[model samples]
Target chain A: MSDHHEDLPPFCHPVSTKLLFGVFFGLIGLTILTVATSALGSALGMPPAFAFPLAMVIATMKAFLVCAFFMHMWWDKSFNVLAFLSSLLFVSLFIGMTMIDTGEYQPTIEAFDINNLANVEVSE
Target chain B: MAVADSHNTHDDHHDLYDHGEFIAHHFDSAEQQFDSGKLGIWLFLVTEVLFFSGLFVAYTLYRTNHPEVFEQAHVFLNKYLGGLNTIVLLFSSLTMALGVRAAQLGRNKNCSVYILITMVCATMFLGVKAVEYSHKWDMGILVRSAFDLTYTHPTPTTEIGKSLHISDYLVYLCVVPALLLAGFLVASVISKLVNKATLAKFMMAMTITVSGYFLGVVIGIIFMNATEGETGSTHASVIVEQPLMLMASTQDDHAADGDHEDGDHDHDKAAAGSSHDGEHADHEEHFGSHPADGGEASFDAHHPDPSTLSRDVGIFFSIYYCMTGLHAIHIIAGIIALAWVYWRCLLGHWRTDYFGPVDYVGLYWHLVDLIWIYLFPLLYLID
Candidate 1:
């Protein structure tokens, strides 16, 4: 095995400690950014729809830093990256379909909430 | 075939079988084994994503249908705690990555230290979650029947007596251990009597049986509690009120408006109707206002009656518990995996040529943190 070992490619990819620390701080910074954005968004009168997307964008950035640097997906093989990214594609599909379906009933839901409140008042 | 090609290129080299003990015999070379293992773990992580997508779908569907419910219920979640957990998990992800790097560089001691740090962070994350959960439980905000029971009972404002909380300890220290001891004793006797095993073998069987029993009990308790909040006899009731009363009300309201055929353009009418309902003034106080402009009101002193909001809010809690509870289970699993890797590192099992286990487990840990990255913002920071 030792003789053939020279034929094998190096298994360990040396990621610098500096780079690791950079990613570490980057993640922490982004976390604070996410929280800050939500608080500031609400304070600045950003609608929930806008705030939600803003927060999601920040979170996506954090996820990317962790995945690329901390998880070492950046240096890893393309196939591995492909494998993980595909899951996100499916997740979007799941969310999209559900949202589309739920949108169809939004009017009904709003009306129901209104009627329920009205009924509660009459009973009181 | 690749192995044969390499062999021909290196015909003057020494024996291939002498590579290292960690490399499995079937693999052509260590790189092949490592790449194969890396690919396998990535595939497993893919499955994990699909597994969790189901829950995310539920979250999206419910939030879309009942944005007000999420808006109201999420207020009860402490953003401070959620943020703290996010940082904790992120730090753990860092430590896990560092640990894998240490192992890859053959720095076993540093690797063990990093894994230990990762485990500590996992424990801390769970600790924060426990605080959040217990708070929710005490407030009668759990899922389904538990929420109903607690909502009705409305545990007094006074602190729970010490004795009332001892059941958890009883379950953990006494009940669990006693069950394990009994299992081990039975297994040892059976091994001796039926298999005619030696004393040492019997002891080994006993040990395995006991550990397995302990693990099963722990997992069972976690799963059971996750699905149904502590359903001891103390909280049990034969009465079964409608589980989805609020849901029914919403549906009825919608159906009633549907009959009128102007639901789509009746935003002002809906608002007027809710404002007219004197009983839901508190609800309207929040719901009637634009959430963005109501930022200051988010911290208002008014507390909605738990009973009145139980139906809609209960559904939110159900999703909250299921998502966070399942995430907590993954954290526990990650902790165990890290512990195993830490132990292996101490044993010098991983080195530059073979740190696959550490690498793979680190990937799993990062994924756990990744999920929480999204979870924190969605569940806690829903402005």
Candidate 2:
């Protein structure tokens, strides 16, 4: 033991309890908001399809709060953040490509796969 | 900590601060080890994101193809239960983050408390999922082929909870955990009798946390019943509540639909032909009369969409089970990880510079929460 006991370095930064509580309550509020807006949208006779994008947007915001504060990406190394964010980039790429591919085959699908309750095959 | 330091071999070099007892020999400094671990965990998280993306892609594909299916199928999912789970996961994420913070400050006891809270939430999540899955199975809501949307829990043929019914599966799933919970309670009391205070406390924490599963089961059943009142888990009830289920159905489309099948399995539709309303005995006579009907005249005004009324509606359930099932798997994996971290915390392994396990596991727990964030909205809240 040395004459003076130097503290261990803060490699993992300790976030304040106050800030943590703030972020947590913020998340709860956002969740309530998302559900409320969805219920409101349906009540107003707005197309239910529009609710999808709205819910996605709210979820993205919640995700941002979670990643930035809860996951500690805000104070983390830029490279680590880059690595995590890149996966999302690739996910969007994959889904986007599939959408494009499915779009190309829409005409062919429409030719045969009409909404017929009678011929609906048991796909289990 | 003293026992751990005895195993440490890095004392050969002179350093300003002493590395913790748990620091690996490969790393020169504690900072290097922590940083390396941080980077590795982030990379693993990256892979996790990519792993779940496949299911998301499948979800998007199906949702885009047959939107009406999603609209009809999602009603079967109890939104109240989904919302409860979302809140539970989010709360657990907060406690996990707090635990990491406590570990950073070297407050092992406080950290363990937070870890216990997180574990309780995780178990509760699985319990609620159990209720949802079993209820769906009882309604014959399976994947594409066996997609029978009838809510009929007939007479129990067995003395034991072992039966072909999916609800019986819940009884089976509860067996192991219930036994484990009993074991933990006994061990906790025994440890206290032996004057092992810490061991007693640890076992007590396990006991309480395991019991959270039962708590979740109770809550899920009650909340589900409250929300599903009057209708009582009936697919017909959900379709009836949604007034616009037949909004897209036009008179000409009915005639156009007539040209679909010369003679197919329309009369032989599983749940539609033989369902809760057992009086509709003559399937062929029933369907030969009205092509645009909701199969039964009683169901026509109530059933929302014609396509939704079909058994192919199981496609949505297929995707639903896959996504949420995968997420549940991750939660179970996370509970194991949290248990490891909690064990290390009990050993007082986390120092200011050596708290890698807590942080890494916190990241993982947060990722699980993030996925559920998307899942709840996508699966339950279909407006």
Candidate 3:
């Protein structure tokens, strides 16, 4: 190992200094972009639904940069990448199921609120 | 498979087991050990994601059901502070990545420096979080009993009112531990001076004393909760007070103008009631005096309707505290991990051939940053 100091293992892909700096600045720029876009979206009176998804898109991009370069997941093992990405898939499923349930109850909830108001008025 | 096997055989001469000193005997090779550890950390990160996913689910459900509540409550959060924390965590992630790189290059000094910087950023992040939490506490916008609802209604039988008053004496909880630790340290020094104790004995005593103090705190909290339960004081009874007045005051001057006719009637009634109760809720006078703080100012400037302050808004704050509190716990863990790796780097434990610890810690730190990346916009930049 001492004699072959110049030889790196086939798996070891050390990122270049220039690339690390580039990623760092890129992250900072994206941070500013997220804030600017959100602020701009609000100022322009964009709907919350549209503004939120746009902001999330920027956040997803930032997260990808961090995971790929900063975390070295890009050049690392495919199993690790799959392991991490699977969590997002599960998260989407969780969110989706909950959204479906909440949507189903929306009308019932609204009716309940109106019923409660009528009861309050009658009691008063 | 055959081509890969041939390539492996071609590089067989370069396969050095000199990593034997650092590599566990159970592993076939250095690469195998590193890969196994990397896999383990990735799996752990997966668990971390799921752990926080539950909170995200709650956030999504609540925001979906009550968008107005989130919009109004989120106004209390300082976006500049949140943005600053986001940048700090991002920089820490950069330093952590660089730290791992430095370790990979056998630059122990630079590795330690980067790790130290990462730890500093973690501390700054926690400091900012503390400021935000304390501000929330002062504004009576906390979870459950932590909120100072007694400011407008001083119910004598309410457990939260009693608990809120006790917070003034929470400083005393620190006294016992400080005294215990100090007494042990002083006694240890005296024993050493008199040659009655070895250095090892003194060090053990100090450790035992610190652990004892923490144990005391845990036992104390358990006892408090048990006694509170015995008294049949349900946690939910401590409802938010001055809700209407606070909500009305939170509206913008212009918005209030349009609703002035009706708002004035409710405002006068609520204000009169609150002031009358305020005279008796002297314990809450500290928070009551600061009605025009930055949070309120911002709330007035970008006011949501008073209707947004329905009781459900407390759920928004409750979710906020839980998510951010859990995230802060992760930040503390990352800080401890970085500090440990930094200490090891200073002792020359990591080098070009065995930088797995630095790499793993860097991965953990990046995950922490990743969580904050989503949390910031979701909680603070709500449209």
Which candidate achieves the best DockQ against the true structure? 2
DockQ of 3: 0.35
Q: List the residue pairs that clash in candidate 3.
A: none
Lowest-sum lDDT 10-residue window in model 3 chain B: B292-301
Instruction: Give the clashing residue pairs of candidate 2, or none.
Output: A123-B145, A124-B144, A124-B145, B245-B304
Tens digits of per-residue lDDT, candidate 2, B51-126, equal 9999999888877766666776777788878988999999999999999988887789899999999999999988
In order, the candidates keep a fraction of the true contacts of 0.71, 0.71, 0.52
Model 1: residues with Cα > 4 Å off, grouped in runs? A1-9, A103-124, B1-18, B148-309
CA lDDT scores, all candidates in order: 0.64, 0.73, 0.64
Query: Which portions of model 2 show Cα errors greater than 4 Å?
Result: A1-8, A103-124, B1-18, B155-167, B187-200, B230-236, B243-311
Per-residue lDDT of model 3, residues B1-383, tens digit only: 11222113124532544334566767666677788999999999999999999999989887866676676566566666688789888988888888888888667878877886777677667655654564455446776323443122122243532664423223343454467567767776776777864443433334353444344333333443442222123221111311333333222233322343233344553344333342334322332343322122112212332322333456678889999999988987886687678667767777555789889999999999999999998998897
Give me the TM-scores for chain A across all models, comma-separated: 0.71, 0.77, 0.75
Give the top-scoring candidate (lDDT): 2
DockQ of each: 0.38, 0.47, 0.35
